[model samples]
Target: MTIDSDADADRERLRELIDELAVVRGRVTLSSGREADYYIDLRRITLHHEASRLVGRVMLRMLDEAGIGCAAVGGLTMGADPVATAIMHAAGAEDRAVDAFVVRKAQKSYGMGRQVEGPSVEGRRVVVLEDTSTTGGSALTAVEGVRAAGGEVEAVAVLVDRDTGAAEHIRETAGVPYLYAYSKSDFGLE
Candidate 1:
């Protein structure tokens, strides 16, 4: 298949896998505390190899669509780590090079007192990524770290949005567009 066709297939497969893996239920108190009837725990799929590959494809497609020049793809550590690694690998496979950074929840007491690790982001374009977003606080925290380190955040992307107004919050607070691969409706929860 052509590259475009392959990317499309990957995106479709990723969506299908997400639909299958996501648990749809009621009474889940989301991070936003709006009482969501469903949740998309992307970690269920993100930790799986096949799902991670598909997710990487989808993210790369999004980056291309956004037309933003990203020097690095990163966000708050732990959850964002694997997703960022997948995107970086996919970019390498596609012959597009991009760096990845990690933002710690707390500044390290040692080792240069670093909050953002990996490639230095100074004066470079960046895209903050997350596995899931509810209130968008964690993602915004990473954005703040990137900015403090002199990285220009071009956009933010999440694997799933829990319908907690995070997208709007990020837009209003950070003035950056937020994108999601799937929502509660995609998993038949809405």
Candidate 2:
């Protein structure tokens, strides 16, 4: 399928931002437990205004292409927060409303004592997003949390794939198709 011009532009802009902010160098250990010569510090981009907007647009386009219905978008906190906020804003601009959520690393110590915060996902179609995926463990943790809360996760999307086999691992273990906007090869690090 063809990507719309606006979406393509957004994706390209995000690529450029990643190239500027993410470190490209020698071997390094990633959270995914894999070795990589380059690392995409997605936090760097997510914290930047333009980069965050581009990410939101790209992710929305990807969700449209996948034909996945989602009422809410979220993932393991911190990394997914900015993307989810951007997505919610972008979707609203398009007249398609979507809620954003955050899955805490640990259950809250008080109140409702919830792990997934923001809105009730029960019976809603949700998409769990991540800034980067290396081993896919963190993303899966969010997915499982969403599932346990009764949200049907249609898929998972990450900003970068380090080519560390995380995508395959997610597909096999979680049974959810993993999507990424860029890969190591795309950044000329492969």
Each model's number of backbone clashes? 0, 0
User: Candidate 2, 155: how far from true, in Å?
Assistant: 0.3
lDDT of 1 by residue, 30-116 (tens): 655657667677788888879988888789788788786697999999889888988898888889988889999878899799999
Give lDDT tens digits, candidate 2, residues 13-74: 78888898875677788776677777678888887878887888888888888787799999
Candidate 2: minimum summed lDDT over ten consecutive residues — where? 1-10
TM-score for each of the candidates: 0.92, 0.93
**Residue-level lDDT for 178 in candidate 2:** 91
User: Cα miss at 131, model 1 (Å)?
Assistant: 1.1
Q: Model-by-model lDDT, in order?
A: 0.85, 0.86
In angstroms, how far off is 17's CA in candidate 1?
1.1
Identify the runs in model 1 with alpha carbons over 4 angstroms from their true place: 24-26, 32-34
**Poorly placed runs, candidate 2 (over 4 Å):** 1-3
The top-ranked prediction according to TM-score is 2
